[model samples]
Target: MRGNFITLEGGEGAGKSTQAGLLAAWLREQGTEVVETREPGGTPGADAIRALLLEDDVPLTATAEAHLFAAARADHVENLIRPALAEGKWVICDRFIDSTLAYQGAAGKMGVDTVRAINASAIGDTWPDLTLLLRTDGDTGTRRAIARDGAEIDRFTNREFAFHRAVAEAFDEFAATEPDRFAVIDGRNDIETVAQEIRSIVTERLK
Candidate 1:
């Protein structure tokens, strides 16, 4: 069986990472094999690019950053995600192309169409079969992120509130436009509640 690919997307602190882990575990409990991973650092090469894109102090142009993300994703899909799926292992990714679309395309001012075009060549037909868009208010998400990461925040997380809001709005617009591909979930609830919702969605999709 060709394995399913699922991507979790949301604003910072939406608990995508946690939910992804929970979903993968639940899938395993049902005797399904799962490959749990994340972006933009899923593979070794991609991890290097992730550090450059996230940690380097030098400011990269929006277009440059988008290209970096594409490059990292290219490596990740080729080296890890694609192989895992080919072997009949469901792949649960914390973030994926949708993040690039929301952050680099919409919020980064590059345009979603352009970012999508750029990434098309990178990952080819590796788009997720399902994307769970975790929804949470900007203030609450930001507070959660700050609390989780403490004083140290990633480059994207350090952006102004307005930027984060734009990212959230972009995710919403994308979900609305592609309702079949996206399942939006309330992310403000406790972790167990959110996890249950995600698991249910994934289970239904599998059926």
Candidate 2:
């Protein structure tokens, strides 16, 4: 059986990581061989590249930085995600191409065309069957991030309020354009509520 691919997406403080973990655990309770991964890192070597991507003081140009991220994603896709899927496991990705589009394309103002081209080249239409976009307000997201992450904020996590707003708006627009593949869920809700929303989407679609 071909495996199911589910990619979770959202802005910085949208609670995607938390939800991903929760969903993975829930699936394991049902006896599924779920492989949870995330962009900018997954495998060993890919994780090394991820450090460069998320680290501050790198000083790379926007386009160059985007290229590196895409390369890392490509590597992760080939070495980790695909193999896991072929083994009939659920591949739950924390973030995928939408992140690039929102962060670099919309928030960084690097143009969607470029971001899409790179994303296409990297992921090559091998998109997730479903994408859960966790939606949250900028202020709420910022507070959540500050509260949860303590002092170790990555480069992307350390953006200004306007930048997060742009990211959230971009994701919202992207989901709107691709209604068939996306589901926008409120991240402000409690964990079980958010998980229920996500569970409903998956059960509905996969059923």
Best by lDDT: 1
Per-residue alpha-carbon lDDT of model 1 for 90-175, expressed as tens digits?
99999999999999899999999999999998999998999999999776797789888444577888888888898999999999
| Segments in model 1 whose C-alpha atoms lie over 4 Å from true places | 149-151
| Candidate 1 residue-wise lDDT at 29 | 91
Candidate 2 deviant stretches above 4 angstroms: 149-151
Q: lDDT score of model 2?
A: 0.85
Write down the TM-score of every candidate.
0.96, 0.95
Q: What are the Cα lDDT values of the candidates?
A: 0.90, 0.85
* Clashing pairs in model 1, backbone N/Cα/C closer than 3 A: none
Scored by TM-score, the top model is 1
